[model samples]
Structure formats: C-alpha cells, structure tokens
Target: MHVRNKSLTPLCGSSRVARLLVPSAACTLALSLSVWSSGAAAQAQGPNPPPLAMGLIVKLKESQTPSVVRLRPSVRPSDAAPSQRARLYAAANRKRVGFLIQKPTAFGAHVIHSGQFSSVDEAEAEAARLRQDPDVAWVLVNRLEQPLAGRVNTVAVPQSGGVYDDHFWLKDRTARPGVARFATAWGRIGANRSVAPVVTAVLDSGVLPNDDFSGRLLPGYDFVSEAQYARDGNGLDSDPTDLGDYLTSGEKQSNSAFSGSSCQVGNSSWHGTMVTSMLAPPAGSGFFGPGILAPLPGAVVLPVRIGGVCGAAISDVIEGMLWAAGIDYQGSPPANPNPARVINFSYGGSGTCRTGSATDTLYRQTVTALESKGALLVAAAGNGDGSVGVVGPIMPANCDGVVAVTALRKDGTKSSYANLIDGSLSAGYLGIAVAAGEFVSGSPGVTENLHLISDTGASTAVARYIRPDVDGTSFATPQVAGAAALALAVNPGLTVPALRQLLRDSATSYTNTYTTYAGSAPLCSSVNRANCRCDTGTCGVGVLDADKLVELALDLATNSPQPDFSAPAVAATSFVPQRGNGSLAGGGGGGGGGGSLEGVSLLGLLAALALGLRQRFKSGRP
Candidate 1:
C-alpha cells in the first residue's frame, strides 16, 4: 500500500517522496528541520546565509531517543533479487541502450532492443511502469529495426581524372608565368613523384564508369533519393552509375522533375568530373598529355554523393561529409574498411554564420572528429563576391580545422569574383588562394571536348571554351585541393593545422591591387591594390607555390630536424610581400589573347626593371 505525504507536497514533490522515505523517518525529519532553520537564520542575518556547520553535532539523550525497532523481512518469491536489480540498473545506464525520444516526431534518434521478453506480461508490465513517468515514452518490446548501412567505397569518374595542366593561359599573360615554370622546376628537383598515396573523398555528383579510370574507382554510397538506383542491398552500387543535376528552377518543381525521362538521365555539365580530372586524370591519357601530377597514383577516391542534380539539402551534405570522414551515421558506424585521408568539398551555399544551424554545427563537429583521426578537409572558398569572402567560408571550410581555398587567374592575379581579405574583416576568414588557370583559356581543345562527350551525347559545355571572358572562383578550387593531396602524399602524418601553415609558408607572394572594369571602378585610388599588402588583408598566404611546398614536405618527411613547420608564426607569415600595385592591363581589352605571355609581359617587365636598377645602384653609375 502507498500513502501520499501531505506535508511534503509543498516541499518535496510527490515524485521524490519514495526517495526521501528510503532514509529513516527521523533522518528525513532532521534534514527538513535543518533546511528550515538555515533559511530562517539567513533572513535574520540580513539576506546572506551564515557559513555551513563546521563541527556541529545533533545529540539526543537516552530518554528522548525512540527505541530501536526491528520488523520482519518482506521478501516475496516473485520479487527481483538484488543481483537482478543491479543488472537492470546497469542496462538502464548503458549509453547505447537508451533511445533518444522527442514529443513530436523529429529525426536523428535511434532505437535499441533489450532482447525479447519471454511473455507479453513482462512487456506490458515494463510499458505500464515507464508510461507513468514524463521522461519515458511507452516502452514497447518488439522486433528491433534493421540498422542502415553507410557507403564506404568510391569510384573515379572515367576520363575525368588528371593533374591540372599549368600550360593554360589567362588574362593575356599580364602577370608572371612563374607558377607554371615553378611546377616544371619542382618536377625536375628529384621531388617529382615523391607524393604519398592519399585517399580523397569527393562529396558531389555520382561517378560514371569509363575505360580511362580502370581499377582506380573505389566503392561509394549515394545518399540522394533519386540515386537510390545506385543503392544495392549490400549498401552501394557495384558498377559506376551516371548522376545528373536537379534543376532548382524551371518547369520541374521539387518533386516534379524525377518522373520525367530527362530526369532519369545524367546531365552533361560534369562539374564533379571536371574537378576530379584536375586532381587525378588517368595515366597515358593524351587528352591533357602523357601524365598529370597526381601525388597518390594509388590513392583511393571515395565518392560520397550528397549533392543531387539541382542541389542538396544541408542535412544530406552534412551526413555525407561525416560519413566520408568515417564518422558514425545515425549512431552506428560501418567497418570503415577504406577511410579517406582527405575530404575535398568543391561545393558551397549562400548562408550567413550562425551558432545552432544544423549545417554549421555538423561542419564543426565533423572537422574536429576527422582531424582527430588524422584526416584533412579541403573546401572551395565559394563564388560569391561578398565582403567576407564566400559566404562565411561555407560550412566545414569556415570551420576551424579545415582548409579553405580560393581561386586565382593564370596571371597569378586573384580572380575578380574571388573572395578577398580586407583589414576591416576579422582573422580566421577567407580561403587560401591558388591558381585555377582561367576557365576560358584552359578549356579542352575542340576535338578533345567533342571526344569526351557524356552519355547523353550532348556536348559538355564545361569542356568547351564558349565564354571567352567569363570567370568565377568556382573554377579555381581544384588547384588547391590537388595540391593538398600532394602535401599529404609527402607527409602522411601532417595535421590539418600543419598542412594549412605549410601551404601558406611556401606560397608565392604577389603585389595585391584592386582593379575594376569600365563600369566597376571605384574613384578612390586608396581602394586600389597599392594600399593592400600581400599577406595582410584578403590575399591569404599569397598564392600557392607547389615547389616550395613539396620541398618543405620532403624536408619534414626525411626527419632532418628542420624548423618547426607547425609553429603558428613561421607557418602563417613566411612568404615575403611584393611591393607596388602590380596590375596587368590588356587581357579583356588591352588588345591581346589572355595567356602566359600576358603574365610575362607585365611581371617580366617589372622583374627586368628591378634587376637593372639593382645592378645600376650597385655600380653607382646612375
């Protein structure tokens, strides 16, 4: 029989009565009296309570004390034994057993089974007991739900694999051609092919099979609902499947496009194909040349498809990122037979920074977890032209432990659309910039473009040099991602922070100047590049210098006891700044094709003039 404690109602709630009764009645009464006395004393002491009792003891005379009473044990055969109680308590406290529940149905919770009960009597008894409490929902005992398996393998896109061809020209050669020459020089320095094999996970459109990428693609999972076709009972597709984009606008609404015939076929834009090609093109593919510089020839490519034809949900993308980096999915992790060493995210969204957003939190947690496992994350800086650069650096990239990349034109000048760093902005913003040869000049030849047609038989617009003058930061990200693969190849143990520093320290410095087209020019000369220093404002660690980076990595790998590459100061600001507003005019209108010549014409002239002046100054003949 249970009796409600009337006096305790205003003090301890009904739920806690059972707990209070566990102690003796006299003890409970004493504790209550002590609490009441303390409150009264605090009031008398003018609001502040007196110090707690140090050595006070409650003493009762023998006459005043109640006589000790002994009662018969009330044990029943049906009652649980002490050992059984202990086992139940242990199971209740187990972290994995508890199912996270919510009032309304929201996602992100898992259910676990405590094994089948022998009879409904036991199951009903548990359910009735738990239902009486507010925290616990009905505890139904039934067959457990099957666990969802995550994709672990990835396949490389056929024909779409190779190192960046530095031969492509941009801006009619107004800046220095040193980057290309540097790549060539680095190749000759015994450092050629010194890169270690690195696994790079591509979280984008699905990959299609081709003869060019034989034995290169690893098995991967497609999370997009439409790509359910790529999903096999074992988890991911065994064969490479074509993936298309979902149009965000037009006749097809959100769910409307999937039913059409065109919806079933993949689009020919080949954004993912283009990006992978730049990083790891097949060997002996004359499309680019005899070979491209891929540090990890045997490095596995894990294609976790999060983005769909049109775009992808932030949640889906986050899950893909976490899964690719070997984070558990929905509370369970796969065997992770082939975990990625580096994750390449070439896509982004237009969103502001916020604390609790799913995208932001997931990105932060994912990066921290991945880095702890010795994996590095590389993301595109985005194509938006906002003041802060790429919309808060777009999750994961903007997150603390990940490296963000911005694009550079062939002339070594930051692309106009590329995000810039301004002094007014805070630190920890803007992506590290790298040269992604101009889109127009780097377009594959007409014959090559025609030859590499998609399954749809439509000409890949990305492969064609249709827009002679258009530029975007989107085209520049792959250069940095590919470079990171090389860095990892040289030093497999390099941490995310160390890799970022190494890239910055070994970067090539250039004079930063802001330029404007005929209609976009600002009147203030102070707004020009002369005022903006290279390593100061928007130019993050200047531009990437592959040769210096390879040298640094090799030095670290050989364990020569060199200076600490992990030191923040040495890593962040080692590159020297080039003085003056080094602007090259003429690629768009200055009357010449945008190519390496433009860079030579502008930077070469400055280099020669600087050399001649130094010689004259030394001779004292001026």
Candidate 2:
C-alpha cells in the first residue's frame, strides 16, 4: 500500500523465490535455492518456491593466512569491542576475498559481505572446514544486507522560537492517559544533545517546498514513475513536489478502468505536508503550527515522494524507503546525503508476511539491514476497522523487525477504524496508538482533536488546522514517529531496536477494552474475539507516552540492546485471526485472512458494488 493522503495509507529470486534455507549438511550444497511451478501457478500472486542466501562467512581451517580459522579468542567481552573483534575476523576473511573495510569494531557488527561461493562443492567444503574449526562463535548464511535506500537528503538551518501548545501531542493531554508527554521528556533529552538533531523521513505523496519547513526540509526524490498518477508528465525525477494529484469522477470510473464506488474524487490531500507538520512543525513560526520536533533543535525532515493521485507502486515505495535510509538503489539518485534516523510510513495494505514465504524472507532481510544501521522504521498498524492480524499483515507494518503503531482517539479508546496488531513479540513488535482524532457519524460537533496545524507544503496561504482532521491510523503513526524523533534528537546513541523497545515499554497501558466512536460491539483483541470492540494488537502496550519514552531514552542513552520482551512472535506464516463477527479472519479483511481495509489500502471494495472502483503497483485518492 502507498501513503494515505490523510486517509488512514518484491523481490526476485527464481521465476519466484519464496524461502531461504541453510543446507544442514554444510558446504555439501553451497548456496542452494530453487523452486518451480508449471504453467498457471507461476502467474499468480505468490512467489516461486525457492530460497536464496545472499551472504555467508567461511573461515579456512588452516594457516591458509592467519588461519581462516582466526577465532575471536572469545565472544568478545562487553567492555571490549566485540563487534569490532567480529569485524576484524570478517575483515581478515574479506581481505582474503578482496573485501574492503579491513578494520572493524564492536560485536554483532559483522560486515555484510556480498561474496557467495561459486558452486555447491566449494561452499560445502568451506562450510565443513569452518564447522570443524574451533574459532568462530556464530556462522550465518543470511549475510547479504541490502544497505540503506540511498544518500539521505540534508537541509541547512536557522534559528526559531515558539511555546509548546497544550494540544501538541508531545506536550498536552488529549483527554487520554496514553498521550505522549514530550514536554516532560524534553527535560532530559534537551540538556544532553543540545545541538544534535534527529533526521526524520516523511514517505508519502510529494511534499511541496514551503516556508513552513523553512530550513529543515531536505531535498527529497520523487519515486512515482507512473506519469498519470504523478500528474507531472514525467517519470521518477529529482523534484519531490506535490504536482497536484487531483482526480475527477471519470478518472476513478472510466479513465482509470476502476470501480467507481471504491475510488474517491478530490484534490490532493497534501499528505506528506500534513505528516511533516506533525513530525517537525516549524517553531516560533506563528499560527502555522507547533510540532513534536519543531520545538527542538537538530531535527530535520526529509520529504520522500512515494505516491501520487492513484497511490504508489510497491516497487517505488520500497525504492524510496531504501533511499531515505541512505541505501541507493540502481544508483540513479546517488546515495542519500542525509540519511534519516527514523522513517515514518503512514500507510499500508492488506498484504501479509506468510511464514516460509520467499517474500517474507526478503522483507526480513531489508528490515534487518535498516535496524543494523540504527534507524527506526515506524508504520501505521492500518485503519481497516478490523483486527490487523485478521485483515492485514500489511507491508512494513506486518513485515518482521518493524515498529507497527495502531491508532487511538483523544479519549484513549481504540479509534473505530484502527487496525489491531498480531505479529510475534520480538520481531513482530507492535506499538499502541495516541490521538488520531475521531469522527462521530450520528452526533454532530463531537469534534475529536488530533490537530497539528502547519503550512500546506504546496500552498501560499497561511497555516491552518483540521477540526477532526481526516481521521485514520495514518495520523497516529506520526505521533509515534515524532516521539521517537524526540528521543533520538536528545539522545543520539540509541539503536533502532533499543529505541523501539523503549517506546513499547514506556507507552501508557490501556487497561480496559477500547470503545469505538459509536460504541460498536465487541472490541478488538489478539487472541480472543470476545474481548474487543476493535482491538489493535492488545492495546499496543498502551498509548504513546512522550514523557515516559524520553525517560526510557535517557536511561538507555548508552545505546545498549534491550532484551526481547515481546510475546506472540507472529507465528511463522500461519495467520488465522478470529474476527469479531465470528469468521476466521484473513489478511485484508476477507472471509478468511484476505486483504485488510484496516487503514488506507486500495483493495477495491466488493460489497457487490454494482461494479464500481482500488497498493499492488501499491492504490487511492481523496
């Protein structure tokens, strides 16, 4: 799914590679990964059944040069650079294979080598030798780490001023105990890294170059290649502006050959701008707005354009995601000059990461790569109005190693449309939500406050605010993102994994079942359908408490890895969620586990829609 414009919002391996397995016999079958399907199965949505290993480390058993058997002496002590010791070993091995970065430091910081043995025999021999040697601590085959997307976007800065507002999610109480108390957290963070800024990436519809972002918005790239949806008349370009993705009835109907009912016609929502405002609103900039990070120094916003009027292609979104993280793809836009420390993807679809699936394997590799870089990826759990596990397993959100954030209302109850969490505890860590506004259908003026006013990146008009802003988990994700940014800004030493744990640990707990806007039946839940009205993964350990998160961040400023404390590690691929209505939920909200309409996916609705309107090439417009 692509980024939602205020709405809630690939790999190759074989003709279809789906899983990666290490040959248990070692070296006998070096780099073995293969799967196939005859005529039709190959054409479906599933990946071909083969697994590919990208990287592997093998040490020579003899003095074949400092003994490829060079042992780490021990697991390297905590006081010592265990990561460095491992790297030195890797560097030595790499040197024999012409590898670069010979010097290494820190433990668990093994270098990701791109070399794979040429044949089965060679790999097996090396694997056998390494196994027999009493040197190495651990040998892993999942080595090829896809680096950060590309060079990060950087921006120059000036000074500004503003007082924290009561409505600011970071400071004020949204009539809920789960709110982020950033104002309090700032006390510790502010004094430590007085000038350090945490770079944040806003992945969404193009953000216009506006004054609100003054000296903080960096030069981002436009990854949407489809000219029609981009409305720019050109494919992927250097410009990341909101080329205006307005749509009409005809576009959603005939011009696009879509279901008229599933699509909406309207002007672009300037989603990236809205999300950026919340993340790093310009401080002391008048009524334009006060942001979660804006009040602080050293926080930069990187605007990455990944969607258009018709949403974005999954390919483009991934590319943008990688680029923002400083990993360049195909090398076109060059490496990100200013890679962000935190990436906020406020949209998703009803897809899933099935166990033993090739797609899931590849997703894990990428997610792990980013985490290794100390970057935090925060995503919306989804706004499908159903259980996320039941309706989703959405990209990034559902993918392993990502922080999945659900949405909540000002009253600390589950938002009617928020998605519930279902991934396992460790890698499938899920985060609860904070104020993402609520819309009352029957009651008028029940105004839900999730306001973060700022300049419409594309407009010349002054700053403005949304009463009950187009509500969705899309909005809630940023609150977490902002809180995270604050933590990093104040304490730059936190690693992605540690930071994620701190956020999860510090969040306010939702002790009771959450009530939907209209008091819907049966709240949401992870294991039992009888317990929730619209559960978003066990209330996600509670709402995001900015103050508490900061406290945790301060305590963990040393960047130590936290012990895994999560539960329900999303079972390997077997997704069978129990829906409130008594149906065995599927990913994407289908009768079984299909696609989720949870947040902002464009899977065309099938209410027997007299045939109307559509994340694949990742889909939506509002």
Pick the TM-score winner. Answer: 2
- For candidate 2, the 10 contiguous residues with the lowest summed lDDT are 21-30
Instruction: For candidate 1, give the lDDT of residue 321.
Output: 62
- Model 1, residue 23: what's the lDDT? 10
Model 1, CA-based lDDT: 0.36
Q: Write the per-residue lDDT of candidate 2 for residues 391-479, one digit (tens) a residue.
A: 44345577766777765556666655455666344444565667665444343113553443322212121233321123455677788
Each candidate's TM vs. the true structure? 0.53, 0.58
- The per-prediction CA RMSD against the true structure, in angstroms, equals 27.2, 19.9
